[model samples]
Target chain A: MSVLYSCSHLDSPHSPLPPTYPSSSSSYHQLDKLYFCEECDAVRCDQCVAVEIASYFCPNCLFDVPSANVRADKNRCARSCFSCPTCESSLSIQASDVPTESGQPGPPYSLICSGCRWSSKEVGWSFEKPTGIALQLQKMNHQTEIVQSEFDSLKEHLESYISLSTPAPSAPSSIRSTRDPSRQISHLTQMAQKALHRDVGGMVAYSARSKGRSTGKEGEKEKYGWDELGVYEAKGSWRAGGESVLDGVDILRDLEDSGAGGMAEVGKRWGKSWDNSKMTKDVLPQRIPLQTKLTKRCPHPNCRHLLIQPDTKSIRMKIKMVAANYLPLVEIGRRRRRIPSNDMNEASEQPTTEELERRRRERRRTRGGIPIKEEDESMGLPLKRGETYLFQLALTNPLYDPIQIRLTQPHAAKDVNTWCNVSIPTQHFTINALKDAWAYDEEEEEGNDDFLIGGSEAGFSEEGTTTTGGGSGMGTLGKKSRLSILGGQGTKKGRDRETGVEKRSNTSKVILLVEVLPDNNTGDRVRFDLEVRYTYKSDEMATPTEPGEGSGNGEKRGKKEEYKNFTFWIRIDLGVVE
Target chain B: MGAFDPIATYEKGTYIETDTGNKVSRKATITGATNIILGGKSIIQTGSILRGDLRRSTAGQHVVITMGRYCLIGEGAIVRPPGKMYKGSFTFYPLRISDFVQIGPNSIIEAASIGSGVEIGKNCIIGKFVIIKDLAVILPDTVLPEGTVVPSMSVWSGNPGKLVDTLPETYQEAMEAKCKSYYQRFRAT
Candidate 1:
């Protein structure tokens, strides 16, 4: 037999070869025959496969693209394998013709390295279209700008024409009248004569008639009586000299004549007889009867007298007369007996001639004597030039009433001169003086004595000049009188040591003692204690100068500084005085 | 002898065996001689070569080696004892295997063990004493160094045979179990 030669390496020659097989076929046939590139790891067939294509580089190397391009393409590189559109790199094609489902041929494609499998499709090659709605919006915006400019120009033209037009002279008057018709009518009448030359009488009469008609609508409705219209027409005809018609005159005349005659007669009698005393006596008797008689005649059986009497019968006339006469006589006798003639004199023991003389002397002494030194010091008494001493008289008395003090100075003068008037209240004295009088002059002595005497120049009397033996008389008054004097004087010198001492040691103590006592003004009535502060300045001090110095030379220049010289307050209880 | 037995004639150094107990020797150089076992109905394509002491290995019955499977083996893809030694220290390196594994014509595998359901790509260099776990994928033209261990279900590529990624767990498991079931079925037969 012929040896079979096989491609199998086990035997070189054989009578019958097993088969002729290729050397590579053994391994290739056993494998799946799929080619896998480890670099790209993409499978490809032999025919369509390409190597090292630049645009086919995979995603891993694409990140190396320059930042500008990265932003332009939204961080994606273009499709260049050798030079990554994103990050440039040398290209290596890992795949050839990858078979399609139809088995059609195609160019080889590449894949990225295993790190990132980004494909060529992810790069900047994709196309997109702008939306239709965005284009329409741009057109609308352009149209709005044109319309706005046209409106602005129209407004400006209207404003310029308004300013340049001439204003009508009568425009204000017309507008004013339009607001109020009544005012317009009156104003038109005034202006028509001056400006329009219109008739005033016709317009005024028309306006008055219109006003009357308008007001008549609001008047109360009146019912017409026959006599009222008749009298009015009759009077009108009479006043017009009887030629005018009087349609109802006869009836009015008869009614007036009848009523007037009766009223006149009654008025005549009343006027003649109605004296106040007589009328009162006639209308009001001594006593009125309790009941009135209802029947015309006396309702007694067999009574001949048919006179009517009061319903209530009277008591006995003799008894009434006796009681009336005796009651009055007894009252007279009692009054006569109660009368004490010189009994009052004897019971009270009329003062003897010597006692009377002594009392009179005491009165005289109190009235004229100089106040004691201690009293003067305690009362803060100061000397009044003509009056000799400080004294208080009753505010209502005819003689020696306390006077109000007044100070006067010019608006330009700093120092004021004071005067006192006995007629006004003492409290108003200073206030009055400050309001009147001009600058005082040393050379003008005409009113000086009158002022010093505490008398109004208009009412000055010689009796106010009575001498009281110097200042000692100011001290001898009673405690109340002393207090009044001190209170007045202390008001002027409240800041001085002597006055303050006298106030603290004496006045306050006296006030306290008086306050503790029962008030007699209203004999224990409810009252409020009122305390008031009063301040005043004393007389200017007279400073002596050197023998050769002139009086005018000592006068100070510039404005004098005003000082609060004294301040004092008084407390008094006011209510019903007890 | 049965008609189903492979009619292979071995030369001086070649060793051959069939599914039905016929044996043949040939002139090819075979190292580390040991027993050859063939399953009941399995077929080995022609032009396939293998060199290793495979006394500890097995082939399932009814296993088919196709024509492309044969060419892959001839291109130095390895199946049984799928690794070899270069400098001879008993350390093994794996060969490249693709979607399907095969024994190439005139190729040697000096490694200690081979994984089941492994796919060895064509034109591979396998080193000595390497352990290849079950269902591993070896890409074409990959060379594994000696003493390397290819883990189970891994897809390996590159010259040094580093792992690319693991095969899907279910796929790997099914393939491995199918190999075992075939082995069991053949043994039962």
Candidate 2:
């Protein structure tokens, strides 16, 4: 199941060490999830890519939340977007039948869930306008106001304590004590000026300090207790009179007795309202949370290229460097059993009626077995010991240039049983150049004739036999051999017929003969790794350098078509053995 | 054939082109065609069932399945309007499918609204009353539960689909081009 090929033993030009550190497990991922870093020439998965937020927008309203306003809105939708207290579905604005005094049909709006039929009217909530429901709800709720005022008073009380706890200011003998009336007079003048300027906050602080200092008895100069700060209560406070905590406890106990049916979920309670109301009936509708877009970058510190740069408003990536675009798309399918000619021998030998009946039962049993009998069947076929299965391994070249592919099984340890021996009939094959669909069709027709003639002749005679055939007439002989090779092409045609695979548009398919050994002890599933080495001309490496900068002008002028070979490994998990 | 992949090739003339430039597969089962408003150049692939007969119970002419331009209803995909009990009566809601929304093969979409540039991959089941905002992608085999709200620029996947990733800003342009090209590539030869 390992989709990515990561090996420490492989020779890399970039890595300093041998990469023998405790590496992660085989990183398996889909093609879309993987990114290719061109700078590092490596594949990076989601686990390896560094992600950053691109933009934020409300999930329900789909309104783009500005980063500046995001904190103020507490990362929730500011518009008339509310989830149902029951089903959590987005609530739609429904207009009530009741009209205004003008009789203009200016009806009040109530939030309603189209899916669950849950309406805000059930909670006795209604809005004059369809939009700005959150703002209206905040103003209408008295419980929130009480909490806000209490929080403000507590913050104010803590502010005084924080300011007084700071180290005393270094005195220049000016404010050594109250005995220095000159310093005290200057301080009073500064406070008077602050008051004239209408700096109420500063004036109040000065007055409080003066009061604390004047009320202080002997030997209690610096010891200003909390009582002297005075009780800073919220204006029009009703919380103390009502005993809100005890009331809340009683309400919670009543809800608990009524069962969990009317209780809000933990996620629903924490979503928007900080009020920990246990009952779903008391739970206010929450604005949907905003979701953020992510921009992915290469995790490699030195090669931090933009792997995926997502646009905020669209489903497209501004810059997408998927590994599928750079690497060959390899697919394994079209499995067929290489059945031996045992049926021919059975046909020649006349069987008795009892034996024929037994054979019929055996055939029926085989048909009902786990390993399905079909040539075109693909995937999850049981692999039996001492049985050979022929599969089509197709390699599609992503590059425009025709690539030469070499596929082989990775060398396994001696202790590990070679459960399956996969042999590529055609080890080295050149894939066609990538082109348009029409161009491919035209090229294919012409290439077929050439391939048939050339392949047959090549298969028929050895290199030594061609040379010995003669000097001037060699071309004619080769052509004649090809023409005759078509019919008398012998075992080659049969082999070609048995391994029916083709290539198209930079895609080459070869028959992979997987012969299971007699001693396959790897249990139900047969797993193996394949090493594919492909050679392609790297035109990108030849960046035009300044003429005669380092090398001679002659060498610089010539185009350097460097053919590089890259090797990668992929693990194939062939399903259950019979 | 030299290098042709026979298994990969589709049958020629499988799709029947209408006068409005819509390449609708002849095999597709489209009911109540009069009620289905297909904007120009939209493709309805083979075996796709568009339930246009499911209209609102209210006594009025309603367009049950209204698709925008360049939208592709993939092979075998079912596009139906979501229905629910409203005011003591079950009523099928009108489905609004915006432009450049490509629904993959075998997906069942019972959504209220599918916004522009949205791609629902193969074998996805978009549940009833689902509202998918613009530029969203529902990955293959995702099963979104009922009443799921998919936001704009988000990627949703898995059963009871959760928002996994967000679409990039350039997605609209890319989807438009992709739909256009896919339409052009589908030849009736």
Candidate 3:
């Protein structure tokens, strides 16, 4: 029988395609390989199989089986077939079992159908059986049961053992006995050592012993002999290698070897050396009055010792020098001399009243000096105006100081009749120079003052002329005004752009007062008021531009200009004399 | 036939409506046995089989019936009884069901929860009583061991079903926020 197979180059194995068969009149074609039915062990192609197949089959049975046969097989009775011993299902014999030809036994098994209760025993066929999975499963189940029982028993035994082994009440006692005794002994020893070191007097003795050991024998010997080494000597002079009583001494000595050598010997012979004629005064021990009497007792009255000894003359000179240099006794002596004594008080009983008054006067003269008049006034300089001065005035002073001026009129004078009032309006400019425009003209050879009002040519007669003085014709006035107007126009045109513009109002004011000095320099001061109006003008002309634009273009022009026509006017008011 | 027997015999191209309103087409051989319940509104595709009693059980409202729910008999999945019994008295039948679960297409859930909010990747096997909790994610071809309990909000994958990580509770919210931010970042254009 021929089985159909379509061989296409479609890469995937899962692609769907129609099976082909071998026929002259149809599209079917034949394939070379044969396929077998698992139930019957019959090999055939796609055209030969008559029964329908359900389980996975060879390609031949897939195409040849009818749909009705497959359905019938699905519904077939399971009891009609013998059952397989291994799987408990009917089977179809695919091949016969081989005979046991060798000494070794062959497999003794039969094929069964996995679907229905069909077995190969109906076809009288058998095959060798290898180890069956069913037998292995039974063995595993038995083993699992045995292991489970053993595990259960083991768990029970462990639980009982744990319960029986719980600790009793003697555990702490046992632990204490096991501890080592040597450790405790060491701890006690350390505590005792610490206690001993903490006793205060014992600690002091220990420290003293340590100090003594550190210092050793050399320090002790030095401490014992220090007093002898400190002593000084006074004795006879000595030649080199000759015995001298003043050996190892710090004392006054002379260069000559006069048998009386040191400071003490020289002092003793001082009287003997003087000539009898020079010492004609009596040789009696001179009674020297006390240079400094003890006035009050020493400040430290509780000190039992007297500050100066009663026999001051008997003190050895060397001892006195040592006492003065090293002891505080000298300071005590000085203090006693400064304070007044309670006994033998001279001030209370000796001096008479006149004598006491005279002594007081002498002390006053020495402490306070005589007074002088001019010196007192010279100390204070009087306040002066215009020259800045610092003034100090009392309320009763004749002239009130400027600082006492009232807030409302700080510059007003205090005395009304004696005060000078000068009306000095702020001067805005100073008058420097003036020039006459027609100075070179021959017809105008007169001085520039001739053009001023009230000059000699003021009333000159002419044909159409009215009086040229105060009551002039308005026509001449108009003509003269035109000349001024023309002059102003020319000036405006000549001025720089910065200067040509008029100034805005509200300029600041600064007062300038001109005082005319009196002829005798003491007469009343005459004052003149000059109102000088100042306007700043620049020499450089401004560049023209659009209305809103700034002076950036003019600044770019490379020219530097100074101040140009600064006009000043002098207006005088004869106001006051000071 | 007994109540445990297969109620409907399925053939290729034949459509059968399950108790859960799902339309299933048989693509391979199958035997229906005892105690099976199929969920509603699901589909069973080609090369898949269902066997065993599912009538007494409960299927969630939106379950998918591509394969079983508890234990997936996998692709090329075979649902058959044990090969042999100890004695002639023993009769065997394997139980297959799609319980409370949402299975992706081509997944074989044999005996597992397939759980609420669970997303199974294509072609996965689930063993018996494996309670995959809510919102669990199973990657493709993952095999779950028997009696394993997957905690809630987790991802389980790999052959032995190791836990990957617990899913974030605000995972959806974060995703939405990221989308909104992305839109806002480019919205100026």
Give one digit per residue, the lDDT tens place, for model 2 in A1-578. Answer: 22345432212312111111123233444444567776666666777788888788887667778889998788888887887777666688877766657654455888887656788988889998877898998889777677677788789887885455333565554245435555345445445544475433354456655665587644223343312344576655454445477877887687778776767677767753545456777776777778777788888767678988877766557898876666676766656775544662355244444554454355435643444343544455577775667776667777777677787765541234545656665677666456565654454343433333322324434321221221113224443342333223222332343333354335667777675654556465565556777776666645343111122312322366655566555655667677
- TM-score to native of every candidate shown: 0.18, 0.63, 0.18
Between candidates 1 and 3, which one is better according to lDDT? 3
Question: What are the root-mean-square deviations of the candidates from the true structure over C-alphas?
Answer: 68.7, 13.7, 62.5
* TM-score for candidate 2, residues paired by index: 0.63
Q: Candidate 1 lDDT (Cα, whole model)?
A: 0.29
Candidate 1 vs candidate 3, TM-score winner: 3
Better of 1 and 2 by lDDT: 2
- DockQ of every candidate: 0.00, 0.19, 0.00
Would candidate 2 be rated incorrect, acceptable, medium or high by CAPRI criteria? incorrect
Q: Which tens-of-lDDT digit does each residue in A1-578 have in candidate 1?
A: 01110111122111121112123222111011122221121121222122221121113221233334443333332432222221112222333345656564334344222212333333312112112211322343333344445456656665554343323466766565445656445544544433454446555536654664577734311211111211111212223333234524643455466564322233223422321211111121001001111112211233222221212222111111111110000000000011222432253244443553453354335433542221221121222211111222111101111212221211211122111111111222211011111211221133223222221212333323322222124435653443334333322222221212111111120111011112122333221111111122212243233111122423433344211111111111111221
TM-score of chain B of each: 0.51, 0.92, 0.52
What lDDT is reached at residue B55 by model 3? 28
Off by over 4 Å in 2: A1-26, A99-107, A142-264, A269-276, A340-376, A381-387, A411-421, A436-501, A515-525, A541-558, A576-578, B1-149, B152-189
Candidate number 2, chain A TM-score: 0.61
Winning candidate number (TM-score): 2
Residue B11 displacement (Å), model 1: 18
Q: lDDT of candidate 2?
A: 0.65
What's the true lDDT of residue B2 in model 3? 12
